[model samples]
Target: MEALLGIDLGTTGVKAAIFAAVDGRPLASAFVDYPLFHPRPGWAEQNPADWWQATLKAIRSCLEQGARVGVQPSAVRGIGLSGQMHGIVLLDEAAQVIRPCIIWADQRSEPQCRWMTGQVGAARLIELVSNPALPGFSAPKILWVREHEPELFARVRTVLLPKDYIRYRLTGRMAMEISDAAGTCLLNVAEGNWSSAVLEAIGLDPALLPPVVPADAVAGTITEEVAALTGLLAGTPVAGGGADNACGAVGNGVVRPGLALVSIGTSGVVLAHAEAPHVDRSGPTPRIHTFNHAVPRAWYLMGVTQGAGLSLRWVRDYLGLPERALERWTDLDAYELLTREAEGAPPGCAGLLFLPYLQGERTPHLDAYARGGWIGLTAAHDRRHLIRAVLEGVAFSLKDCFTIITAQGLQLEQVRATGGGAKSPLWRQIIADILGVELAVTNASEGPAFGAALLAGVAAGLYPSVEAACEATVRVVENTAPRPELVTLYARFYEQYRALYPALRTVFHALAGLS
Candidate 1:
């Protein structure tokens, strides 16, 4: 059987998976973790070399596992990539790394964001890119570097996003796909190409950015050297994959309109597929992002919650001493123990709410200075209450995105849940009740990796098109319907959750200054 390989370069790790091209059956998979560096507060950076090495390890391990399962490396016909979006990796003329990559979590570009808003009026800026200029985007990072590190900026020859950099390493070519390019804030999202106007407004040359193509297009082939390193056949085609969220949508069979995807990984996102670009230019603050989809001639409306699973992770590491002890005793994962404890607590956690702004917020608020904490905490609140409140808070945050999506007149017929948090039934029910929508868990495992492999299949001619691939490979595995009583309860609490951010806005800014 022919096999396709997918590689995901995530914020925390590199994952590689092999899937049968015909029906998307998973054959083998491997993951290798990497460290995220915080050289200073509000800054996140990673070495391109580290990503390359980790990817090599992951690919070799995946191939070995496939071999053990009777799938040969030679059977892998195509490769695709998915990765963390909006990271800027600079290279000199010789394609040598100019500096460590400034990643999606970095917040050092607020001033540049403000400057861009001033140069090209906020409304015009949104008109050009279909979203507001934010600190985490590539355009602001480019401005930040040009102003702060002019000498280094002068030496820069090419700019690539996180996964595209890996593509360069594997194929010896520098190119980017539309879905990932849309996040760069340099792309004309509606047109599915780089915006020369935005580049000119920021005094950046168009030559610095790589060419953009559709996600399923063949980017390049695996070179002999990379093939040797990963035990893959030379001349294997590599498809231009997508931004993680876009690929995740494809993996979950969210290729058409009316199907929404809620992803809860290190961050949270609510996305809906759009047949045409739906730009919300009426709002003074554009809360939703409209980006080119991985599916050809389509778009997606997305709202992001910067801290989703990260909140649960924080509770697990910092406040789950009992759960940790139990984990050692019972061999249960700390998250499992924590969620089990939380399941005992009543929904809404007796009026306690969490903001989940530990890494700041994106949808609705767009404040980089936002802070996260538990509100309405009293002596009556225990660890169970805290854990349940965190889960409920993330669901509420996603509900914020759902509100924006519906406001745009996009009907959400089905909501598919994908990511680490979606594995928990309790959390899935919470999200369903909070959003007032039925939730589904698809048969597709490995989310973005699976989508990448499907794209690889299309590029390799194993599938006629993206829709055909999804029709053949993706299926709904489970469903969770909203409970009316819980939905009413969550509706009341969601209002309370919404009020906390505005009330604490000034205080959060003040605390950020003090720090």
Candidate 2:
């Protein structure tokens, strides 16, 4: 039996999983965690060499798992690569990594986003590219490099996303997939190619970007060096994978209409698969993006929140976590311990509300200077109340995405929740309560890696199409439906949660000492 392999180079880690193509289920998986570098405030980067190291380490671990269980490495017919989006990787004439990649969460390029909005005009930019400007996107980062790091910018010959750089290491290939390219804001989303006009406006050359390919197209084979380290055969085909968000949708079988996906990571996002590009020029529900999906010729509409798990992390590490109590009460499980405490609090967090926009916000507001804080905090509040507010605040943020999508006439019947945050039952329930929709949990929780394996199945001819691969392989463990009473309570609380930002908008930037 032929097995498929998938590699996902995510924000914090690299993971690889193997699945049986005949049944479309994962057989074994391996992972390696890495560190994120924040050399300066609002800047995030990862070394390309570190990613390749993790990728190979993960693949070797997966191979060892297979061997321990008596599966042969040569039985792996194809591999696929998936990764985080909107990162910038530069290569010179020799194809060496130019510098550490500027990741998706870096906010250093805000000035560039604002300048582009002024130069091109928001209306014309949206008309051309189908979304508003985002600081972490590829175009602004490219322009920033030119302005601040002109020496490095001039040395660029080709550019790739985070995972594409890994593909380059694997097969001596230099290419970008459409879905990942779309996140760069350099792609003509509707036409499905790099936009020369936008490149010119930004003073970036089209040649700086790599050639774009379909998400499932063959990228390259494992070179002999990689094969030797990985204990795998040479010339193993590697399929062009996808951006993490698009691949997460693939992992959950969100290929058809009326289905949407909600994810909570460092950032929050709501993505809906569309048959074509859908643009809404004017509404409270503004879209930051419509991008090519991992599925060939398909597009996805997305609403992104600047902060998601970041809120939880802030609450856990910097705020009111009762550390000693959690070690004893919840087996050192921070999320469960927090949720158990939250479950004790009444809905609305006892009138304590949080905006969860420590990094400003996306979705309806689009205010980069938006601030987050606990409202109604008093002597009566405690750890449990504060923790509950954190969950509710993040839920309210995700609901902003749902509101935007539904306002555009796409009624989401269901949402499959993924990411590290999705593992918490209390967190998923909070989201369902806020959105009033059923949340499904996928059997394989490794979203991007599993989806990359599904792409491998397609490339190997074991599955005829992406939909077919999903039907053959993917499985949902169960559904998370909102309780009627909780939903009712959250509905009222959500209304107030929506207003916190507007009321405190100016004070956020003021507190930060920004004009």
Against the true structure, whose TM-score is highest? 1
Provide backbone clash counts, one per model: 0, 1
Worst 10 residues of 2 by lDDT: 280-289
Write candidate 2's Cα lDDT for 1-515 as tens digits.
68989899988789899887787667779889888888865678988888889988999999999887767888898888889898888899888888899988787788889888787778777767777778768888877888899898788998889999998888888899888988887788899888777778877777788898888767788889888888888998888888988888898888878788888877888889888888865563245478888888788888888778888877776775575665679654766666777888877877898778776676767665677778989999888888888888888988888887777777677788888888888889889888998999877677788888888778877788999988877778888999899889888888888777777777876865553
Clashing residue pairs found in predicted model 2 = 24-473
Candidate 2: regions farther than 4 A off: 320-332
Candidate 2, residue 190: the lDDT equals: 92
What lDDT would each prediction earn against the true structure? 0.91, 0.82
Q: Name the lDDT of candidate 1.
A: 0.91
**Native RMSD of candidate 2 (Å):** 1.9
Model 2 C-alpha lDDT versus the unseen true structure: 0.82
**Model 2 backbone overlap count:** 1
